[model samples]
Target: MKIVNAKEAGEQEIERLLTKAAFDQVELNPKIREANRKLFGRDMSAAELVRQIVRDVRNEGDKAVIHYTELIDRVRFTPEDFLVTEEEFQAAKDEADPDVVASLQKAAENVRRYHQEQKPKSWMTYRDAGSILGQAIIPLDRVGIYVPGGTAAYPSSVIMNAMPAVVAGVREIIMMVPPKNGKINPYVLVAARAAGIKKIYKIGGAQAIAAMAFGTETIPRVDKITGPGNIFVTLAKKEVYGHVDIDMLAGPSEILILADKTADPVYTAADMLSQAEHDPLASSIVITDDAGLAERVAKELEKQLADLPRREIAQASLDRNGLIVIAEDMRQALHFANVSAPEHMELLTEQPFQLLPYVRHAGAVFLGAYSPEPLGDYFAGPNHVLPTGGTARYYSVLNVETFMKRTSIISYTQPALSDVSSDIIRLAETEGLQAHANAIRLRRK
Candidate 1:
């Protein structure tokens, strides 16, 4: 990692670095334009596939869903197997480690409690002339939570995805994860059941997303899909977006630590590696004002990486995207951090609270060295599903709001219409919208 002084980078360099690049260009500079020519650049091949699946499911319903599930997942299952029963959930819950079950139970509770505070309430106002306006927040009838099943059973995702829907009062929460040899992970199953999820399907990848979006024989259609997955799954979600609402097009996990000389090297190192172990594409960087502190943190990172079980993966990520930028001062450090808009931002400074006001963009912010990013991932009360690949500048971490929709209500009485009719007609006519002008003009009398 090179320690570059932000002031020396120049305004042009800063602009180039800070500007959000296309999603594919984050870690590597690919010959994408060339590659696209070879592989049909910027086309809707994926979208076409999702459209076909949706049509099949919409027309054929359950039978089409089952056929796709069999073709895609290669797992044969009846409808009974799709919806996990209370007995099956209990068995999975019982089979899990007592300590792990306890931990997951606690994590689910904390997640639910935090999201409960985020629940939107319905409000309305009525005027003396009988004009009324309001907003009604309504949860989706059914929601699908996709948990990655095969490689590592992400029980944390279960809590992060399902708890918000639960808090938002979503009626039916369905879960789909790829089955390992046709069986779901006991821990994942237990966690889902604990998080108030009523359904679990053994499917994964783009096929799983397709099923959720289109609703095959075994899986019912979901109003929205929420969770993380691999490139194919992510791309599938991106493709099927309009057919069903999606949380976000998540990329590889990332963490940016903004620390001062007073920050702990050990904690910073550990936090950086947390995202690094997720995947080689995952990025971990630190912005600091002290060069010596950067060196210390880099040394600690190397030392810590050596001992980690996923050292090879973490090392690859650190070697490629990881950086320690030494800024001229704290102001420059914060400026760089905002431009990056990392998925996870940790303020490991002497005064984390004081520095927080300057943070313009980040999916989630961890205050103080003790508040590690992983605390939000598992045991802490915040959602771990955050925007990645610089989308944090506009997107937010998954919350209860993600699972619900808002509808605006407006009612204008004769008096209200009389008050604003002439203004409305004038504005409409100015825009050459005669029909709009006539609509208001007719009501004026």
Candidate 2:
């Protein structure tokens, strides 16, 4: 990662480096583009491909879902092959290492416990003239979670997405994972079991999103869909959003570290690489007032990446999106960090907690040298499905509330209605809502 002096950089330059066009429409890489050309017989944007796949699934149901599974993922499935059977779950349990299963169970329990506190409480209050105002918290009846599957397995994704729904009291939840080698990853299955997910479909990609949104012959419709995936999956979620609720349009993973002279370069470089290793688009950045620390961290990053298994991806990410900004001071560092609005932020300074009150925007904040991003990603019990691509300014991390809806409760006695009748009628009439005035007027009578 190259180090740039923040004072020398123009505002436009900083923005272009940090917040520029991260949300620009997803583009397919050359390999995927070639695959798309061969499969669809034409070149199309990621949005175009997603729209066609979603429309096909909307119209042809399971048949279209199976067709895309073969074309996109290179995995074949019949309608009956969609839903994972009990035997598969059992096999996953049997095949999984006993210690790993136990660890996942513990992590899931921590997630469940954390989300239980986030469950919104319903309360009613008596008001003047026998009026009562309240809210009813209703859990979604059913929800679908899309767990990405390819060459990797992330049981943590399952735990992060599912536990909140389970804690919110969702009645039924199903999972969709892209099949790899004609079978779902056993560790993911182990996580599903730990998180209390029942129905799982081996189907995946944009078609899996569409099946959940519109409902198929085999897969049932759901109220919301959560979990992160590749660009195509994100685009599909964007297309089907109005038809179904989505957690957030999360982009590639990223981390921004605000460090001071006291911060350790080795720890800082390791943390930065943690996010960079996620994807080639993933961004790893450091903002520090110390130019010496900046140089040391950059050197440490080069040294550490030499032996990392995913060095190619991490190196590509660093070359493309990573940087170190030499800020003037801690205050300036915080200012630049808030402007970036990163998904995962680390405060590695003399007083991490003292800086907390100034943090304006971030999906999750990691405090101190010991609290790395992965702590929250796996065992820390916070939802890792966070807003990225500078969307942290308005979006939120997924939580129990993501699966729960609140409905207002209104109850008014005759006296209460009379007290406000004229006011309501006057406002309704002022707005040209004659029917609304009539309803209140008739009720008054």
Candidate 3:
């Protein structure tokens, strides 16, 4: 990727580049708009497909689930053997490396500690007039977590996604992951067992989501679903939202670093590659005020790219979406960062604390070069399941709250009702809802 100086670029040129840098578009401005219009005009075929899957699984029960699992994941799993048995768990536990298991144990403890601080306590208050109001913080009855188990198996994902629900006092946590050639990954099975997951289902893709949302004969319905997946899996969550609560319709990963001359180019480049390696759509952007610093970071990116196991994917992502823009000052750099609202923001500068006040949006902010994105991804206490594709402007990282629901608690005494009756009737009458007005007025009478 070419290093561009933001201050030197003219208004039109900067605008064009910024527009191009955005993910919602690929081509020129007019072409990008046209493409968006075309995409939105199309039918909801994907949603329709999900609906059909939900209907079939709900009606046909375990039979349709097996059929879809075979058709989608290309794995044969009879209902009898779909659930992970005690023997399988023991074998997986025995198969996992001792050091790896120890690391997972430590990470799980950290995750639990961080999330436990987020737990909500129920509170109630009674007034002198005999009115009481308070909310009860209760975990969902059951929660389903979808972990990707294809070319890679993330035991860390299992720990991060399920531990919060477990700590929240969820009744049961059922984990669904695709099996490879009808066999689940030993490490994943070990992780699930270690995390205290009771039910592990050998199924994945949109089919698993449907079963979790609507419930089949074998897989029980869950009150909430949480985890990250591919595009198809994310779209499925969007479709099944009302059926069950979902964490978020997450997109590809992203990271934006605000670095200065004092920052380490090698560390910044390595962090960018960490996010880019997640997927081809991932973005790794660095905004700095020094042209020389930007060039060094780019060089470090090239050096680091050669060492990555997923270099092909990460290189493609950087070539397409990655950028190094040199700004006139740190303030200007931060302005662009806020506009991007990256899922991960690394403030790799001498004055990271000062910059923290300027950062208004981001899923999580990594304070210094030592605090890398992967720390939060696996070991750090905060959630790694973050909002991506600029959704950080509105959404937040997953936490214990994701697995819990809230209801407003409202109670009013006779005096309270009588005091507000006239104003309520006035507003209700203005809206032409006499029934609503009468509901309050009758209580007063």
Taking all chains together, each candidate's TM-score versus the true structure is 0.87, 0.98, 0.89
RMSD of each: 4.1, 1.2, 4.6
Error of 1 at 109 (Å): 1.4
lDDT of 2 by residue, 245-351 (tens): 99988788899999999999999999999999888888899999999999999999999999999999999889988999998788888888999999999999999
Question: Residues 1-445, candidate 3, lDDT per residue (tens digit)?
Answer: 6577887774345435533433343223254345334544533445455666777877787898898788766777789977988888989888889999988889999999999999988888886567778888878899999999865789899998988888888999999998888878888887887789979999887788888998988889998888988755777788889989899887777888999999998898889899888777777889898889899999999998987899999998898878888988888888888877888899999979998998988999999878999999899889898887667878978888887777767788898777778999999999999999989888876
Q: After best superposition, candidate 2 residue 382: deviation in angstroms? A: 1.2
lDDT of each: 0.82, 0.91, 0.83
The runs of at least 3 residues in candidate 1 whose Cα sits more than 4 Å from the true structure, single-residue gaps closed, are 1-87
Of models 2 and 3, which has the larger TM-score?
2
Q: Sorted by lDDT, highest first, which candidate order results?
A: 2, 3, 1
Kindly report which residue stretches of model 3 are placed more than 4 angstroms away from their true locations once superposed: 8-59
Find the candidate with the highest TM-score and give its number: 2
Native-referenced Cα lDDT, model 3: 0.83
By summed lDDT, the worst window of 10 consecutive residues in model 3 runs over: 20-29
Q: Which candidate has the highest lDDT of all? A: 2
Q: Write the per-residue lDDT of candidate 1 for residues 1-445, one digit (tens) a residue.
A: 4455567776456545544343555323344334333444343344344555556656776666566667656778666666667777788877899999999999999998999899989999997678999999999999988898745679999999999998888999888888776788899988887887777877676667877887866678899999998765787788778999999999888889998999989988889899899887778888888889998998998799878999998998787677788888899889888888888999999999999999999999999978899898899898999998789878989999999999999999999888988899999999999999999888876
Ranked by lDDT, the better of candidates 1 and 2 is 2
